[model samples]
Structure formats: structure tokens, C-alpha cells
Target: MNTRTLIASALALGFLAACSKPEPVVEAPRPVVVFTLASAQVAPAALYTGEVRARYESDLAFRIGGKIVERRVDVGAVVKPGQLLARLDPADAGLNAEAARAQLAAAENEFAYARAEVLRYRDLVAKNFVSRSVLDAKETAFRSATARVEQARAQASVAGRQAGYTSLLADQPGVITAVGAEVGQVVKDSAVVMKLARDGEREVLIAVPESRIGELKKAGRVEVRLWTQPDVALAGRVREIAPSADAATRTYAVRVSIVDPLPALQLGMTANVVLADAAASAGGLLVPITAVFEHGGASAVWVMQAEGELVKPVLRKVTVRQYREDGALISAGLTAGETIAAAGVNKIIAGQALRPVAPARPAAAPMAVRPGAAS
Candidate 1:
């Protein structure tokens, strides 16, 4: 009786064990591509193309308006101070001068006659021949005539200046960079006839993109190289930076004054401006762009913390100074020798267990087959 009962119990226990669901299998930690923060060298220097220009450029124009009958100098012509660069037709100016002189002569004659009459009146009054009121009237007339004569003389001087303006003269030693008016062209007063670049300090004009403008401002050293002499680098500094971006290009215009510019650095020559940092390690740490994620409107990364052979992702906020094609510069909140998730950051949860893996190397580009080469 005991053997049969034991057999039945064993069968029932076997059936119960088979019917119950097996415990769920524990899953292994998933692999995550991670990047290690290394001591980053300064970002490659930014290069910009620009043109050489004079620090003090002037637009040459006539003080008065007239037809341009003579243009002695063309573009690229160098002139000295008071050198005749161009001229206008002097006939009209000459006629105006002559008319002003004639008016002055007439006014002087009138003033002389009035003075003589006043003197005669004074004498007559002294002799009791003329009344004192008559002498006073003559004196008043003489004063008015004198005033008219002075006014005429002033006008004549202005006319003389106008005549002198007919001949365009260089006020400073410079090279003509542009010519806006030609011979026989009627130009208005103060109209630009040419552009002169004075012989003095030279500068390079460059435009920088808005994104890198801050870097440019904080640049440590600037160097300029002319296209004509690429091998030689001229030291330069930030002379001026546009307060606002350009409307068309959305870039800032920067003027770099060349220090002790060589004679070879001429106007309008193409030049290259290089902006670089002084120290190599000033760039802080560099991390993959994909590794950074936004957390509470601030940049953050999933750092891979190791614990007993297992890596756990810990979210850490970081200060990103700049973003480049290669990576994001970590200026603060991180140090060298830190590991972070490189990609698929959104899929990771804070403190989640993960298997840290090195980033996959980029596939090598296929070599091009040469024509008539072996297959």
C-alpha cells in the first residue's frame, strides 16, 4: 500500500512542476559605443581670405562743379602733395573772377567819392558854410559805401578760390586707386572723381562668419600672408571688429592692421588672415558631437562609470564652448580621461547598466581602379 501511494504522489508532483512557468531569463547588458575625453589640442586655426587696403583712404573730388576737361592721372598713378591730378574747364571760373573783380573796383570808386564828399562837408561845417546835420549824413553814406567795398572784396576772394579749384591737385601723397570721372564728364560739386590711398599704415580687410566671430575676438595671434608673397607672414592685430553683422553675408567685417607693413604689401592684393590660439592645450577637452545631449536646456553627456567590471552610464552636465566638424569643445564640467557614450545617447537611461565598447573605425574608402590595370 505505501509503494502505490508514493508512486501516485511522485506523478502528481512531476505534473505540477511541468505546468508552472519557468522563471524569466536575466538579459546581459547591451553594448554602448563610448568615447574617451582626451586632452584636446587647440582647434585648427581659422583661415580667412581678404584684401589689403590703406588705413586712410580718401575720395578725391572737386570743391566746385564743372565739366572735367583734363584728367592727368589714371588709376594706379602716384601723385605728390599739390600735384595736379585733373582739371575742369577754367573759362566759367575765370569769367566769374573777372566779374567779381569789376564789382570790387566799382565799390571802391564809390567809397572814394563818398569819403571825399564827407571830408568836404566836414570842412564846410567848420567854416560855417554847411550844417552839422549835412556832415553827419555824408559820414553815414561813406560808412555804407565802405561796407559795400568790403563785401565786394570778400566775394572776389571766393571767386578767386573757385578759379583755383578748377585745377584738381592732390592734397597728400597717394596712389590713385579708382577713377569715377573721365575727361569731358560734367561732375557736381563734391562729387567723387577718384579714390586715393594715402601712403601710410596698411591694413587687411576680412569678413568672418558669425559663428566664429567670438573666437576671432579672443584670438591670441593673427598673421597675414599676401598672395604675391605667400611664404612671408606679416604680424597683425585686431584693429577693428564690426559691432554688427553684415546684412547681406551675415558676417562681421574685421580690419587687421599690419605691423610695420613691408613695401610689398600693396593695396588691393589678395591676402590670407590666420587666427590661432597661443597654447596647444587651451582648447580643453573634446568629445564626439553625438555624445552630447540636451538636459534641462543644458548640454549633457552619458559618462560610462566602471563598477566591478561593469560600466554604468551616469548623466553629467557640461559646458560646450564651441561646435566643430569633428566634435564639441568641452570647456567646463569635464576633464581629460573621462569616458562617455558616443552615439545613441537618447536610448540610454541614467545609471543604466551597459557594456562599454570602443567606437567603430570608419570604413576605408575603396581604391579606384586604374584604366587598363589588372582586375
Candidate 2:
């Protein structure tokens, strides 16, 4: 009686304890960061490598053709205005000048003789010793001789200037960036001997591809970051844009001037020209590029539905008119102010529950009130 009664009592106790135990509690919905889609004119930032350059650059050259006798300044030489950069062989220029001087001297002697003859003829005419036509011929001779002398004198002045042109001088204070001609090399008039970058406002030179040329033309907000000093970024504006694309690279040359000058930014420093996505100019709501994913050959975003205690993500197809490197603008399918999952969109699936958390920005559409938000 004891063994059977004890076994049955133990079984009954075990059954009652199991039945009294509460059912397994369901897990709370996963909390997720949900931001309301805002209509902000934002675009992805683009970056391009470039070089820091002077706003004003000029090519120094000889004004007259001659063999270079000496090149005083090399590349990277800082020069002041009127500084002699190079010298040319002045022998030919001097010879031409000398010949011009000799011609002027001979023309002057002829003019003096003609003047004497004109005076003698005038005296004879007044005394009625010569006919009027004869005196007129002498005056014509005098006028011709005087004109020849002036022509020869002008030639001599031009020849003197030609000799002076043999010496190449800097027209402005600048640093020499390039040397195109060397000593013993014969260069023609205006042949670039050196490249001068004037000391002034600094600029960044970048080549924008044809695809991005439109953005350059607008000259939207640009920032230049130096390679040596990545932390230092200078805001800049498009100072000049080439009218046509480069024949070799098929890229347009763009010059961006620094809004504020800094000592660190010098001529020919490697830099990065950052261009903002064309959204500010063209109004559109910006979304993270990663936020939008492609599925079934179509683009879509994950939208949340607010349940009493759970928020569920539902796949919504959106029309994307344009895209940026880091984000995209929703052309259609997403409504302003609706909460959308941005952080872990790939992990989410239809019917997956979540906890809706409001973002910093005000939501256009109210978010689902969390269970504890009622207070």
C-alpha cells in the first residue's frame, strides 16, 4: 500500500506543477532605428584628385627669335617683375640695329643736302633768277629727302627694340613651374621659355569628365582637401571652366579658387576637389544609396507599418529618377514623413516585426508609438 500510494502521489504532484507553470513568454519586437523620409535637397558628395595652382599663370618667352645664350632661372625659381630670366644671342639683333643706324645717317645727309638746295632755289625764285616750276621741283626733292630720313629713323627705333627683346624678363612676381627652352636652343618670338605662376589667390586645377561637366558648369559648392593635410579642407568656387573638353583626355579643365586663403595651400600642392551631388540645385529627397536595393530587376525600399506593439517592414517598390554614390532620391513610391528602415535594410523581410524609434529630424508622417511612449 505504501509503494503504490507514494508513486501515484508523486505523479499527480509533477502533473500539477507542469500545468501551473505559465506558457512560454513571447519575445518583444526587435527595436530598429526608423527615420521619416524627408524632402531634403541633398546629394552624394563626389571627390576628384587635383593640384593646387595659382589663379594667374603666364608663360615667359622671348619677344624676338634668337639662340638662347643663357637660362638664368630653372624650374621652381621665384622671380620678381622685370627680373631677367634668360638671355639670347644678341649678335644678329645688334647687326640689324647697326645697319638701321647707318641707313638713318645716310638718309639724314641726303636730307641736309636737299635742304641746302631748296634754300638756294627759294632765294633765286625771289630774286627772279629762276622759273617757278624749277623752284617747285627743288622743294619736292627736299620733301622726299625729309620723308626718307623719318622712315629710316623709325626703322632704327624698331631695331633697337628688337635687340632689347633678346633678354627674357619676368612680367610679374611668380614661381617658375616649367622650363620649355634651354641654353643653345633657338626659340621663336613668343616661344614659351618658362611657365610663371604669379603669387596671389590659390586655385585647384581638376579635370572633370564629360559626364560630370554639367555639375562643373553650375559651379556648385566645392571643397578642396590637401593630400598632405587631409584634415584641412578649404571651401572653394569654380573660378574658370574650359569651354570645351580636352582633346586628349576628353575632360574639361576646371579651376576652383579658394574662398579663404591659407599659408598651407601653396602652388602645385596635390589636392582633392570635392563636388556635391547635383541635388541642391535640383530639388529632390535624398536617401542613402545603400538604403535602396535591387530585387527582381527593380529598385525598392523597406517601409515600416506601425502595429500596436510591433512595427513590421514591408517591401515597397520606388521609382528612382537619379542616384548618387552614397544615396538616392526617391522619385516615386515613398511618401514624405513615412518611417523607413535605413541601417539594416538587407536583414529585414516582409512581416518581420520591429520597434519603431523616432529620428532626430521631425517626421512628416507620425511614427508608430512604442509601447512605453504612451506616457
For model 2, the superposed segments whose C-alpha errors exceed 4 Å read 1-44, 210-220, 278-295, 298-375
Which tens-of-lDDT digit does each residue in 1-375 have in candidate 2? 799999999999999998896889998777776766653322245667888888888987888898999988888898998999999999999999999999999999999999999999999999999999999999999999999999999999999999999888898998999999889998899888889999988988898877787777786568888888876768889988899889999888988888886776678789988776544233445566656888789998888888887788989998776765435766668766776787677778789779877555543322111112211
Which 10 successive residues of model 2 have the least lDDT summed? Answer: 366-375
Candidate 1: which stretches are off by over 4 Å? 1-43, 277-375
lDDT measured at residue 261 in model 2 versus the true structure, 0 to 100: 69
Clashing residue pairs, backbone N/CA/C < 3 A, model 1: none
Deviation of model 1 at 97, angstroms = 0.1
Candidate 2, after superposition: displacement of residue 315 in Å? 16
Model 2, residue 134: what's the lDDT? 96
Index of the highest-lDDT prediction: 1
lDDT score, candidate 1:
0.82
